[model samples]
Target: MTRRPRVLPLEAPLHEAARIMRDEGIGDVLVTLGGRLCGLVTDRDIVIRGVAERRDAAHTTLGEVCSAALVTVGPDDDLGTAARLMRDQAVRRLPVVDAERRPVGIVSIGDLARVDGLGPGVLAGICQAPPNV
Candidate 1:
């Protein structure tokens, strides 16, 4: 898991999130409200939801485009549980939170890939294409 994951307030603008992602070399930022995890905004969310939708990045807030229905894992959860959550949710990353639901870290598919035996199978499941809408 990546400790000290980047975070931003829900009211932060999309451009600010994009700048942080670029400067920090990260793909996503955890969105918070009242210091609690609320959503996630990925680079893809910026381009697809913000740019493609013609929303002004400077005016659009993270909460406007972030994935709010989160699927998080607790710090005490096992790697298998994390992997299973990612596979089932089709998400590339999961925020690792504590008892109060404050984000402690993030677990990604790449992090699972480094494990001895869990990588390939979980990755395969995550990579399977979604059916046409």
Candidate 2:
């Protein structure tokens, strides 16, 4: 529920964005401008939109396929409320946003699974946190 998240700038190359995602071991990246959430890009977008479409990662910008239709929620919103919104909307990720539309941490189905009040092992496969914690 932090109010500041790691973000990729609009001009970053698609490949670089994907690299960062992989390096961070996260599935999505929040795009920002002037410190506010502007878009969201996921692994699926890269493979489907970028690769399937034959986009040149070297030349393609994150802004090209980044979904400006960011489904976001306030930090104060409960985990259950956030999970329901994601499920009902058929989205895998949500960008936590502030009143000014600034991105906070992201919550994916994985993160939600952790908060679903399930027992420990219930999330071992879902959240994909670093191993051997």
Write down the RMSD of all candidates, one decimal each: 5.6, 2.8
Candidate 1 similarity to native, TM-score:
0.87
lDDT (Cα, tens digit) per residue for candidate 1, span 14-113: 9999999888777899999998999999999999999999999999999999999999999999999998999999999999999898999999877777
* TM-score per candidate: 0.87, 0.85
Total residue pair clashes for candidate 2: 0
Alpha-carbon deviation at 106 in model 2, angstroms: 1.0
- For model 2, the superposed segments whose C-alpha errors exceed 4 Å read 1-4, 121-124, 129-133
Clashing pairs in 2: none
For model 2, how does the per-residue alpha-carbon lDDT over 1-133 read when each residue is reduced to its tens digit?
Answer: 4335568888889998888777866667888878788998888989988999999999998899889986789888988888788989998888998899878687777766665455656564646557332
Alpha carbon lDDT of each predicted model: 0.90, 0.80
lDDT computed for candidate 1: 0.90
Cα displacement (angstroms), candidate 1, residue 4, comes to: 0.5
Find the 10 residues in a row with the least total lDDT in model 1: 124-133
Clashing pairs in 1: none
